[model samples]
Target: MPDFTTDHTEPAADRVERFQAAASTAFAPLLVRAHDGPPFHATIRAQATGGLLVSDIRTSPVTVNRPAGRISSSDNDVYKVALQLSGTMGVAQDGRREVMRPGDLAVYDTTRPYALEHFAAPDGEIRTVVIACPRHSFAAGPDALREVVATPVPATRGVTGLVAAFFTGLADELPNVDASGTHLADALVDLISLTFATPPRPDPSALTARMIAYCEANLSDPTLSPRTVARAHHISVRYAHRLFAETDRSLASWIRSRRLDRIRRDLENPLLAHRTVAAIAARWGLYDAPHVSRLFRATYGVSPTTYRRAHSGGF
Candidate 1:
């Protein structure tokens, strides 16, 4: 995150231009104005973590453009995960178009071109959150994930809903988070990975159920150590270890494996062209660059950068 200012008084054209200039280093920009209609207003707040960026945007009716030329020439691939808080909107991508209603989630890639047209309610308001990250961050193979890339992925239930909720909540809380907030970011990534990996289901075992739920709930608290979890459950640390041991895994091992899975998925995404392999790894909580490289190669049988380059068509 960086210092930012808000100006609601400027004319639409000037405001849009300013915003475009500010975001151009990170993304290709477009802002459209509504004419002969209700008042159109927009507020944008953007923050970055590694190559992943989260943007909270509320705007009035306007058309969004992702031109074909820009798509062909841009160095970085963009994925816009849009959550509609209110009103109705439409997105056109790769010759396919879909309209999104309230409580719906949709993803679109910038490597290819797309267009979005939004309509405000009669009361003249449209509110939404748009999280724009490098497409590779989502942790799915490009070919397997592309079919659903720009289409709406409903977050109305289960793991998807939980992950979506966590992201939206973080956007509202990021202003209050500081350097110590790294834990929160880590948890968000984990929850997102779990959400994308597992179908909606209840845990079958009590110990596993409790552990997973607690982990999801306290991902932001760095002090959420194994001791803390043991204490909360009225058990000893040894017992907690035994619980995981019964599953043939340790708590630390599970977490590390989960994090690695996320990194591998992002590395294979075709839409994350602009981000380097190291950047993607760090973004998902693999802090030691060399360690990440070695572990990724050992586990996946390919280096992180090489995997990303092969799948994403990156240079």
Candidate 2:
């Protein structure tokens, strides 16, 4: 195992520069802003075991951004799982904002943009354990991962609790190790894989929930349909329909509604103002511009352009 640690005695006057350099060495290049200004306080303890890097980050008030401009095509091979141990942090990614309290955990992809801001802790410092692994080392595929990204998983009781307990306990005991990560990496990978697995003999509601999650994760795919969803879950199209019958709407209707909803959401988001109406529509799988215009008029009583103007003050 390779270990790196930032000394706490380092002078605060120049800590920001030292912190950024140490951070980049510990993990990747991250845009770290010190909310407390000069005389900042932060420390990082990072350990590497094969393809996995576990980091214990303790810092004062700060906001971290993994900007899109900093990401390269070759730099997106890792996924980061964060376990909040002793503080509150707001995690923003994939259009979802989650406030993760102690014992809450979530995963995020390094390939995309994400932001994290730490709140004031009881001890005036925030502590979080983050583990990074190569995407190939993880069991879940990209599509499946989209559902869980930035989505907080409570660590009360279940596989999630087990993961939380294991990592938190590891943070407390890793200092005693004999400088070896013999099985630590493999165990972490197996634990995470178990967390992502589907439970055995799931009920109809659970299965339906899984199907809906699949749909939500792949809303941008034009080929995402009842048949494709059924195939993804290893069920027949009829069985998929039967499951959807339990819901208020049919599977196909739900898909269409969700796609339009995503488009409308993007149009209303000022952060996405750079995207054209057609581009936003296509991003959610509605590729036909004229058809989408008609659908928007029929659904919202306004064209997409007008709707964007009304909601987001034009794009």
Candidate 3:
């Protein structure tokens, strides 16, 4: 892929204006204000890999803002995930704010008002790799996603750490890849989804959320019943059922539904075409072939075989 970069080493008087224009063009239409005084400096080196836009940015202290006027004129409706490589950045959106240090990650939507305050260290420059894509790129609800915007995702552990490492590796090797890099882009999106799919652990008393997290992690275990789930979380089976009383289904039903959904998705995945429907069902802990077929048909209004056929263009 070809690389695109902006050079801000022009006339010192107009460097700030030039940098602002370049920044807006590379990311989105927004206002960039120099943090302290004159002689603003910044650079944006970007590459388009498949459907993803990856950019490495190095800039002095500055605050980027997306105001209502700019949003009304052009709302891109895209999500920007930034991995702080050096220095710190403070992101504010949807009433949430987070200060992202080195190795920290943050996400924000471009359709609404937001601000990014980039702070440099003694080196006088902050570095980051920003990935931008349409909001629909991930299978998540807008409202539900908005709730987590501007929240800092620590890169020291768990899925976020893995994602941070992947981005760092990609940025390092991006100059060598000669193709579209679509597979890499897809993996990045998948990791982002996985990191966010797990509920945020704001407090320990979020037992229901903990249960959902545990269930999602162990969905492939056929023995992942309410008993196992409760035991894993150190709660009683009766209390586990009570925790889900307000939900539409019982704990067991919810797990089964999730497993079935995974199976249905696999059935439609072209990459999994070689696998049989029974095998896919078993992979998700639905070992009973007849029961899986019946439940799948009832949920999707089509048998697994028919669904795969339709998705694969074989019917």
Q: Is 1 or 3 the stronger prediction by TM-score? A: 3
**Local accuracy of candidate 2 as per-residue lDDT tens digits, 1-315:** 234444557765467677776765655667887786435777677666656777888887778888888887756378888999877998888876767788878888888899998887787768999888788887778887776677666677777888998888767665653335748777888888776543454699989999999999999999999867875674546668889998899999999989988888889999999889999999988899999999888889999999999999756
The residue-level lDDT of candidate 2 at 129 comes to: 92
**Clashing residue pairs, backbone N/CA/C < 3 A, model 1:** none
**lDDT per residue (tens digit) for residues 1-315 in model 1:** 353333667776775565555445446655354534544466667666545567666666777776765554545676667787778788877655666777667767777777888788656667667766555566655554455544555577776687678668856865654444445555655555453442333443686679868865664353555656765553435556767887867876766666678777777776765677777777665667899889888888888877777776665
TM-score (C-alpha, index-matched) for candidate 2: 0.59
Q: How far does residue 205 in candidate 2 sit from its true spot (Å)?
A: 8.1
lDDT of each: 0.64, 0.79, 0.79
Count of residue pairs whose backbone atoms collide, per candidate? 0, 0, 0
Q: Order the numbered candidates by TM-score, best leading.
A: 3, 2, 1
Worst 10 residues of 1 by lDDT: 195-204
Scored against the true structure, residue 19 in model 2 reaches a CA lDDT of 73
Candidate 3: what lDDT?
Answer: 0.79
